[model samples]
Target: MNPLRLSPSRVNDYLNCPQLYKYRAIDLLPEEISLDAERGTLVHTILERLFDAPAPTRTPELAFALLPTSWEEQLIARPGLREKVQNDKEWIDRVRALLTTYFTLESPATFEPTEREVHVEVNLTESIYLHGYIDRLDIAPSGEVRIVDYKTGKSPKPGWEEKALFQLWIYAFIYWRTMGVLPKLLQLIYLGNGELLRNAPTEADLLRTEKKLISIAEEIVYSIENVSWRPRPSRLCDWCSFKNICPAFAK
Candidate 1:
């Protein structure tokens, strides 16, 4: 059997609902194109390319200028995506606002990112591998590493912050296992509302995250072997694309 390939998003799918995972990861069903998700992709692309220029030139105006070309590139990659936006002008304006908010939080001209859209992969075991693309990775002058992720949406509410940080903790775990160095910081930059969430993960925290991931992977394997993919109904189901065919909602 091939090793179970897992990303933070894929793992979250399983954790959220195993049956939803089967539809996406196993059955490979097509999901409805989300305008918000596409917008996030466009913003991410512009930000990634923005760093290519000299630090002094990494200004919000430059980021705004890159929008048209970046969006055209996205249009080429996903032809059908354009139709989903009812108002092109309004949609582009929203993207511009996100870039403007980003500048207020951090001056990209001040520090250079060690990596952007960096692909990270590490094997947890012979049968399980963890991998994903990190939005940004920065190495401080003192050698402390920081993992940063950009969010086009609003920050999660107070009690749900830990749940939101779970994704980054998984990334931290992979970095530690592969690089033999624990990242000193994990940061989430919420462009929608201009809020920042930061965490300093400890060694023990990442170790627990690793164990949890292993257990989830094992559960996935067992479900595959047993041919048991059960739907988990929650408020999130309202947004799930596969709800119409979900067993839990079947009449």
Candidate 2:
């Protein structure tokens, strides 16, 4: 059996539709470029760049100034976006709205992050590796650690938050496994509406998350050995690039 590399996003993809997972993680099928994806990347890039300035110099004006260059840098990396968005000015303006909303949530000038875009990986088992990139990491003088993630989309409503929490749980598990200390806070900052969801994870919660990952890894390994990846059709199918090629969508 080949070693399985499972990230939070890939785990979500597999749960959403195993066939989609096979197309992506296994076969490496190409996906149609999405404007929303490009815009999200642009916004995230600008936010990350905002921290590159001196802590005192991190301002909304500076974040806005970083946009054009960030967009240009993104364009160079993903030139396909140039043909996707009809009006670059309008697109940039939309991204500006998100950046403006971000300032309303937290003053970036106030907090000095210990790390940005931090990549982490941990071995779940001999055959499984859990890996992900954290948006920002903050450490207090008191030895408390915080994991911060930025989302360009709207915050999840009541019962739907579990889905959003899943990624943070995985991050918490990784941090605990690697550092031997659970994070004091797990945060998700939604730029769409200036909403911040923060959770102080307990030892019990991390243990539960570890149990969940072990179960997920077992399921993935079984699926791999059996070569059974079924499709799950839902609203998400509407936006899936492979819908035309998927059996669930076939006549």
Q: Report RMSD (Å) for each prediction in the order shown.
A: 1.0, 1.0
Q: Per-residue CA lDDT of candidate 2, range 1-251, in tens?
A: 67799999999999899999989998999899988778888888888888889989999999989988888888889857788889878898899999999999999999889999999999988888999999999999999999999999899998888789889989989999999999999999999888999899998988898898889878877887899889999999999999999999889
What TM-score number comes out for model 1? 0.97
Q: Give the clashing residue pairs of candidate 2, or none.
A: none
**lDDT of candidates 1 onward, in order:** 0.94, 0.90
Can you give the TM-score per candidate against the true fold? 0.97, 0.97
- Candidate 2: stretches off by over 4 Å: none
Indicate the worst ten consecutive residues by lDDT in candidate 2: 79-88
Q: Show where candidate 1 strays beyond 4 Å.
A: none
